[model samples]
Target: MSMFILVSGPFTDGRVWNEVVGRLRESGAEAHPVTLSSRPEADLETHIEDVVRLVDSLESPGELVLVGHDYAIHPVLGAADRRPERVGRIVHLDAGMPQDGDAALALVPDPSVHELLRAEGGPGPVPSPGPAQWQRWGSTEGLSVRQLELLSRLAAPQPPRTLTQPLRLAGTAASVPSSGILCTAGGMTVELVEALVRTGPPQFRKLADPRVGFFELATGHWPMVSCPDELAEVLLRAAAGEGRRLTVPEGESPFLGSFLFDTPERPRVRNGRLDLHMPKPDPGGAQGPRPAVLFVHGGPVPPHHEPAPRDSPLYLGYARYAASLGVVGAVVEHRLHGIADYAQSADDVAEAVELLRADPRVDARRIALWVFSGAGLLTADWIAAPPPWLRCLALSYPILAPLPGWGAVGSRFRPVDALRAGGGTLPPLVLTRAGLETPRIAATVEEFTAAAEETKALLEIIDVPHGCHGFEIHEPTDESREAVTRAVRTVLAHLEQPS
Candidate 1:
């Protein structure tokens, strides 16, 4: 028999787990819901102590399973680390994986909330939003109106220190087996995680550990409120290690596929963060420096990924294909290691551009920048002020607007707002839209296109009706091939225009 300990996240307490605990009990399992210190000054340590003390007080003698939801995972992990011997299993329910010295604020997926917490001289305790604004925390899908009212009525402001204080760990708890409950409505799924793991990022690779199990809930982030019975059932299943297991296939990278067009060997030279692919000279003779297309691959990829994006098969293929067109193709590796490092990554892009211009083999007066995916944010700056040297700008399945709940952090990176703010004509812009893109992301692209129309920006749209996000590498159909070819040709045509 397993004794279950449930810890609720911020803006609520043990009461939030009432129905879930009841269901667990009805199933013949011993369950306890924890309520931490409500004092305004209570910090992370206080909450960790609360969980540790609860474990000490439990009189049950069987396996102990610690379950944490959202921000509560911090304390749960801390306590588990301190009492590793007693904890049989640890479950992370719709919460981030925070390492030692990480503050909960940094783990917040919402750019707006992250900025607020990072700013100085803010409110002491963060107030819970109204039920209508619950999406800011996580998706409210599947939550009934009565449940929303209950949540609003019982919500409490969270202590500031609970989010500010860094989580400290001795790493002992890492040895304990763990389970993860991913909420699809909250923007994560087993499929997405598996895809990321396939990208060969070092941090995501740890998820393939056999000791870890994963389960997905169709409900929103607050499983306790939206689907308590289901949550309880999953909790029991997690204790039994009966969830999906993530495995890494031993073969070529899944993110890598055969390029639409093949190219002959090209000269590859590395200059700091940029990989320059030099085109073969024409049969007549060698020409002067040629125009360059700098490919900025999109990602919040882990910093420790081996080979990096520049060396990845997809990016390498893009660069090589550019060279095949008789133009210098360049791939830049920037430090977009995590969501919070967008500003830094943008700076890296600027630096890479300057480096490309300084090279003698590249034409400094003509350059086209092509950005993809999350890297679309870096385009905000270039769009706001198109330099004379910038021939064209291309974006593929780019995020043009800030994601919901991505408040201030995404504000600076909104290309849609940037175009509106610039209120000036931009160079020819080519955008490739994915018909089957995720709704939230497609919304951003739609918002950007709408802004372009309003601002009368010079834009051409390419549609991949049957394509998903990253269709070039993932779709592999004739449509995907045609779209890529058209985009590359359009960009090259712009580069060839009078300068």
Candidate 2:
């Protein structure tokens, strides 16, 4: 069987390649998901060495295909450069090809991105793209909650050093056949494509080379999630040495067939106090013992596993996307809110992680905690005194201050007071608020920022009203989805960073 190595982009582990890898394997390809070491503290040479090791381990006399997605184009290309003989072709899947003098973070037009890099305390040059510029380009319309969580995880502060260091690709374009899958529907523009191409090394200067190919898709950036069949076909075509334009059907719903799991309710009692509703992986292929995400639902009175409102695009959409990405999402019922108690809710998240870890199919190292609104408070408390195995966190629209009596019969919660009291160092925070400019949401974000001593980012969506708490639940307008998606993508990229 032909061998394929799938390398994921920054702020992402191997799980992001779940759909792509599954499709490749179903088509009889021997696929291996490679995890790259992307710690901001690590030097460029060290990162290159890590990829070399993985590629060498897979070395065989038979030809192999190396696929790099997004930020991974750098390391994957470096690996190919190191061992071109055993490798068959290098596929740049909607990714940027880095040259010796090109800066990785320079491509991102966000000054806040530099703030994040600086917060990470790395010695690297920050890109000058101001927050205003990035805000103009980043969009988050139609994103699911799971997608938001993925974005939040990816949105962490990146190390400035990694962005400042230029990629060093030494081979000529003839050494390997290259292909680019640009998803136009995901908001990629022809102008951006031209800019990316122009930034390539001298070897890629000749656009007419048969070995060089470019194709655009009218799907979200995550074609594997939004349009898997189309993406699979594209990969197959690339593998067969056929390069042609591939586009989604006219007026086809982008959300069709995007979710990979059945939304079944597997309610079970755990730790004698919490209820866990574990959904099965979406249809197509089940990757056993998948890494799990503990969902802490918002609302002080809503059921933990209630069907998300149709207007809330982030909830169901996010769950399905995470499952499609090979993550086992567990919605935890928290205390006094969402059908459970605060203590029990925290315990439930920990227990779910433990259970998944005990299962042989899970990687254990990739478990994550995700919560929103009131549940965000519970998640933050839990993280303050975290379990040893906790891998990362994704908290959105968090209520940092309990106020005097938020849920008490007559007491009111004062966010300002809470911020004053909880003045300790905090985890990296990704804060999102509605753009309709309500005083409450703005005040909430302002309070949280003041209390946070660690890295914190604020994503303000324009035109969203304050009452639309679950705006990201349903298919948002194109503009909102794009805004949210960009922020989420940045967060996910940050989480994928090596600790």
Candidate 3:
């Protein structure tokens, strides 16, 4: 027999867990749903104390399971840190594993709410989201009309400080065994986490711990309200340390599985951080230095991710393909490792460009930079002032603007804004857009296209109507192959033009 302490996240009180609590108790286990303070003055510390008090009051002799949902995870972790001995297992129910100094506001998906929390000394209680806007927090699948109504009605305004205040952990709770309950409809799954871990990020490798278990709820983020019985059953199983253990596969990442072309390997000359694939000398000998195309791979890849992007098959294939075009092909390792590291990444790319220009085998006057994915932001500076040597700038399924949770990275990363600024003559810009792009990224692409038109920039669009993001590797259709070939030849044509 084990005792469960259920804690709810923002926009709700302990009552949110009533149905789940009842089901857990009916299974012959002790269960309690804690209601955090509703006062406007209540903060994270106050909420942590509320959970601590309940833990102290519990007289059950069974194992103690601390179940935290969404924002409540902060307080639950804090309480567990103070009383590690009392916490038998910590169950993350559709909640994030926030580290010390992480604020709940950062985990929130709604931009309006994010702005509200950033406003210091603003309003009292944070207003609850309406039913129509509930999707901003998490998917509402599996929820009935009555359940949605009850959820909206019972939703309470959370204290603003509860979100704004940074979480302070003593590191004691980490030793406690843990289990994760992923909500697939809310856009996370055990398989996805496994894939990410296989990508070789050291941070995610911690999930492969033998002591940590994993489970999935097909319902949305609010599983307690939408599927209480199922949530209760998972909780009972979690208390017994019974769930799937995540594994990091020994195979290469899926993103590196395939490439558009099946060209033969070329001789690669590696510098400190750059790999240059030298093309075969012109059959008719005695030609001028060959033009080069430098490929910039996308990411917010973990800085320490093993087998850096430059070494990946996707990038190596592109380099070899470029060499086959009778021009130098280059791949550089940039530091775009995290959301906040774009500035450093820009610097790294700039250094790589200088290295390329100084190479004796390359024609510095005829160069093209082809960027992909999140690295699209790095084009802002070049867009603002098109250099004489830059013959073309190409982007594929790029992020033209920052996403919501990126905070204010300033105009440095906003390529659309740079386009609208209207500076020097823009380079021939080539853009390949995926038809089934993520909504936020699609918005940025649309915005960039509009800006390109407004500024009358020399722009060209390649439409991958049947493709999704990362189509070059994942979607190996005739369309994908043609797009890759067209984009490459187009860039080569620009490079071949007489200076």
Candidate 4:
């Protein structure tokens, strides 16, 4: 019989694994459930310690199988590095694997995700959850009524610093076997899973090592809740070294196709300066000028082209998607961070809109802005004092206001207080946060809604509790991605309507 340690996501306590652990036990295996601290509170190192403590207390001399679902990948990987000899194998079940110095949750690829992490004061060591905090998250839908009650009685708040603690696994390799059990049913797209395996950074790249394997289950993000039997079977297979290669199905790539632009440049003056980018459609052409969408990249320091091909998610994926739908999409590069005020980024957006409006190929009537974290705030400022042609705004975890706590700006340039200082009227807005319940994120949205008022909708992807800011771009579960796509579509439709 093998000893199995199953870890759950950030908001969840060990109780999430009750059914799975029971199945493992019934099948003659010993299983332990590991819990992580909730967000905006716990950091990364504390998380690592929690897992280490659990493994050490087991007292089992034989190799242990470690399983991490979602956010638990950080701690599990860290623990394996610490006790490679005792651990037999590691499994990342739909979880993002972290690289050296990269926060675990930061592995999510969305720019809004990066911004959200940044807004939360940059990843650092987080605390383990104590009983009360675990109980709160237990009541979430995935757990059964009895399970919730049990967790409520047994749960605890994790420490606050576990999130930011860096897990040192650079030279240390996992001596035990590893596997990634990806969920395909619940918003987990084949595209994302394959991308994570193929192109994900160093931390995630570790999963592809020869000693590691892969498995795919047609389950949602919470497989233990939605399909315990299937999850159990997959786990058993991996434990027995019977897992197989998991491959994403081939198709006309939904996100990688290219579209041709008219090559005409839209140029306009705003705030006493001319701004320029690719132009939209003109009415006189065979088709009316198409509605326009502008994607603003994050960071004040990195030039738009500096992060070009990698940053091309904007140009290649999103902008192309919009263009395919008859929407004029343009990627805007804001001025470098230190040289210009962050507010100037917003001005640049306004200028881009003006340029789009002036272009003979552009339909100035319908314009939309999609901005991620750093750019999201800048876009918000521009919307606060919206230009005449700007029609709709879709902000993915936009930092409408400055974060309230310490250590929020990790490696990124901090925004000026003036960017979100005074109360100002904002345009129709769609606001999202990673962990909606976190005090800081929730408060930020509340403040944003108060400013934007009536013409706003707030969507918090519950499954993606922590890295909401930019996680969407990292290709979150299909449900989350659909929700975002829907939000963008709805906003675009609204912008196209008579105002």
Top-TM-score candidate index = 1
Over the stretch 1-499, how does candidate 1's per-residue lDDT look in tens digits?
7789999888899999999999999999999999988789999999999999999998877769999898999999999999998899999999877777767775665555665666787647777778787777778999988888889898888888898898999999888989999988867778766755654334666788998999999989899988999999999999998888988654324235545556566899998989899998878886789999999987767665765788776778888999998999999999887666788888889999999999988899889999988788888998888898999999988877655333325567878888999834578999999897767778788888999899888999999999766666553678888999999999999999987
Scored against the true structure, residue 336 in model 3 reaches a CA lDDT of 72
Q: Per-residue lDDT for 412-445 in model 3, tens only?
A: 7789888999778888999998886766677889
Q: What is the C-alpha lDDT of each candidate?
A: 0.83, 0.52, 0.83, 0.57
Q: What TM-score, over all chains together, does every model reach? A: 0.82, 0.42, 0.65, 0.47
Candidate 4 local Cα displacement, residue 387, angstroms: 1.8
RMSD of each: 3.9, 25.0, 6.7, 11.9
Off by over 4 Å in 2: 38-40, 59-61, 115-143, 150-160, 172-174, 186-204, 245-499
Q: Which of 2 and 3 is the better model by TM-score?
A: 3
Candidate 2, which ten residues in sequence have the lowest lDDT sum? 403-412
| Candidate 3, pairs of clashing residues | none
Which regions in candidate 3 have their CA more than 4 angstroms from the true location? 60-62, 120-124, 250-499
Report the error of model 3 at residue 18, Å.
Answer: 0.7
Candidate 3 TM-score, true structure as reference? 0.65
Weakest 10 consecutive residues, lDDT, candidate 4? Answer: 250-259
lDDT of 4 by residue, 1-499 (tens): 7889998875568887888988888898898987665555656766777888988898775789999876688888888888887888889887754555555433322233334445655554233334333322222334456644554455454343454456668536446788878775433443444443432221233444567777877755667876788788889888887665544322212222221222222332222322223333445656656677776655433333334422344334555556555676666656624212455665665676677677665678777777665454565355435555566667665555433211223322222232244324444555555553334434555666554434343332223354443454444466556555666576677568775
1-499 per-residue lDDT for model 2 (tens digits):
6677877655456776677788888998777877655555754556567767877887565777788876667777777888787777788776654655455554443435545555754455333223222222233233455664664454333345555566776764346777777666444544433322232111223443557667766765456555667777787777777775323221112112221223333423343322233445558666455555555555544233223321122344555445444455455443433211455555655665566566565556655666666555564554444443455556555555442112221111343343345434433434555543223334565666665433332223223443233345333466556545554454444445554
Q: Where does candidate 1 clash, by residue pair?
A: 111-406, 112-406, 112-407, 112-408
RMSD of 2: 25.0
